[model samples]
Target: MSASVTSTPVDHAPRVPAAPDTAITAVADMARRARVAGRVLGHAGAEQRNAALCHAATALRDARAELLAANARDVAAFSGAASFRDRLILDEARIEAMARGLEDVAKLPDPLGRVLAEWTRPNGLKIRRVATPVGVIGMIYESRPNVGADAAALCIKSGNAVILRGGSDSINSARVIHAAMQAGLRAAGLPVDAVQIPPDTDRRHVADMLAASGLIDLLIPRGGKSLVERVCREARVPVLSHAEGLCHTYVHAAADLEMARRIVLNAKMRRTGICGATETLLIDNAIAPVLLPGLVEDLATEGCTFRADARARAIVPDLPPATEQDFATEWLDAVMSIAVVDGVDDALAHIVRYGSSHTEAIITEDEAVATRFLNETDSAVVMWNASTQFCDGGEFGFGAEIGIATGRFHARGPVGLEQLTTFRYEVFGNGQVRP
Candidate 1:
């Protein structure tokens, strides 16, 4: 999808600050530096860019322990509730994963300068759409320090500059990762400003990034609903915004009970704090009696908590009552909501009304049912007989992602290296005239 203006701006609304003005100004200056660097990067050879990514991979691997140590400081200093603590904590495995992501990005083909499409007219006019970097990107995210590395690596690989504004809770970790990325850039004889983490941890800087529409080509907010909503409402710049992941998994009557059971358990409990985790399980009424009981019991054994509708509660009397909010919530925890729909139509209707249009799945043996679900679901990623967690970019073999965009304009699914690029028309003409 291409970017374009949709409407006129209105009154200013209250926005969540990303940092203090002093810090915001420093970051803006850093971003300006990166923009200059990006001009060089945009023309840099693919081999040089790959070399930088290779260096980043090595730096990340060598600094793994130091990175983890820095992350530990952030985790220890976290004063928020349990949920915040969960988001703040990072371990050796997560750090290693970040390094691996950088290495994988290094392996992918460079997206910059590649010719996407071309055409020639009868009047001897020719046009080619070539991929180009999207310029400086301001990523405002929360808690997850690993995102800093991921965003930096993806932007660098795609030949775009990046400015990261991570949550205050993860300042230390973000700093360490950002330093490693700069080291990689310098090692490849590239400008260190190519990847920057703002010195300010105050919340107002997010506003500055958003308001600097001419400077930041895109503002990607990669956190919860409130953060994304704030960016969408306040940012004058274009936003590839993604809100909640109130994802769903529908178990149709034709579904294999065992497969449905396993998929549901994995989808909901494998990792609950991610956007792709299934928050609601929609079971066909025909299969609800036969499959619901076992599914609920299976999930319970895995330490999962559930809020069930009347039908589900009847089947599993010990289940907690499901509320309206439960159906609409993206419980990024060990909690899930259950409802029994009449059939495929009801399931589709329910998802259309309540889903966040992030990821949705259907478990069915009938090809027609599965096909319908896939075709009808209006989400960035849709699946049949697969877990919602598969919506991730890494799983889709893109190395890493900026974030999963649920919008229709620029990108819909995983915003990976390819998604980070915008196409420009390259035209060639031999004495062609408009007349």
Candidate 2:
């Protein structure tokens, strides 16, 4: 799940102080509206849906000043760590990126109404599995306001309506963003309820959303470990877990020194707050004496702190000794844990022990070793000579992602247009009766 700097979200919307039952009723009513909207969106033509996305993009761009103002308020209200604040603050470039994200989603191939597979039955009947929307998606996220826009746009393009619950600190920004999305829907002649947020960011509303079993088709939690765990444990509806990103970057014995240095720096420091940032570094013992110093120096120069295992500490004696708990932690900041392994197998074993099964990368020139790492590493995304940060929906050419699922079933990795859809069988038969 996404991490938040603040525990209590600032309320931007006016509150009525409703009873528990009232909150439940309100959530159900909103979900029912979303379900209705989802049906309309799901059956709409691809062109119409794309039009809505383009309008949304336009709306986002036009509302740039308003968004920036709202985001500034959110940032001011947030009393969190600097890294998380970085995630919350939005600038012109980030807003433009979000707008472009919607446009990019509009340009992608329509995921609906396509034939995923076709087969002929022995009885001369034609059967095809056709793509369809998952109906209504419940997106529970934190800090990043862009998540709400990205989720709304992706859900709209894939023909699903979304109910967003952004973190408390981001309530002001979320409201402005949600309004822009609705405006786009209205301009495109689509139901405005297709993209909705609750009246307030009450913690109780989360439970209400969780209990909306029949109303919500799927619940996707995109926050910290606690948030994901709670959703997966309590949600009555089907859930896709966007678990922690305890990612790793391994430097193999055959790794290019220059390449390893560059990849390691980018993977850990490019954007330290994101889920794809490398939290752990595993280096081969064979190359540690020669490669470890330079790598450590590079990361330290970028203000990165280290927690080192005995083997790693042996190479860099001044490094803080890493406890087992440190290896398991997702710092989500500039802190990283280092382990010196014997070889690829050792690296793999360490990863298996500590990784979140999210993303991992190997820095090596040997094709055989790269292939082995790629094939053997049990992660949603495995890269060779590249940064783990590349495990993003946009980089994968999906425009933007709803979230990166760590779960095994249904959707895994970056959830995009295609991942947002499930398929239904369409069978054609004529004059067929029981023999």
- List per-prediction Cα lDDT, in the order shown: 0.84, 0.89
What TM-score, computed on C-alpha atoms, does each candidate reach? 0.93, 0.94
Per-residue lDDT tens digits of candidate 2, residues 354-424?
A: 88999999999899999999999989889999999999999999989989988788978988999999999
lDDT measured at residue 26 in model 1 versus the true structure, 0 to 100: 62
The 10-residue segment with the lowest total lDDT in model 2: 1-10
| lDDT score for residue 199 of model 2 | 91
lDDT of 2 at 414: 87
Q: For residue 277, give model 1's deviation from the true position in Å.
A: 0.1
| Residues 1-435 of candidate 1: C-alpha lDDT, one tens digit per residue | 111111121111122244455645765676667778787777788887777777776777777787788888998888876755776787877777887888889889889889988888888788999999999999999998888888998998899988899998899888777777776776777776777776768776887888886778988999989999999999998999689899999999999999999999999988888999999999999989889889988988988899989988888899999889889988888899999999999999999988999999999999998998999998989999999999888899888988999988799888999899998887898877776
Between which residue pairs do clashes occur in model 2? 1-223, 1-224, 2-222, 2-223, 2-224, 9-168
Model 1, global lDDT: 0.84
Clash count (model 1, backbone only): 9
lDDT at residue 85 of model 2 (Cα atoms): 95
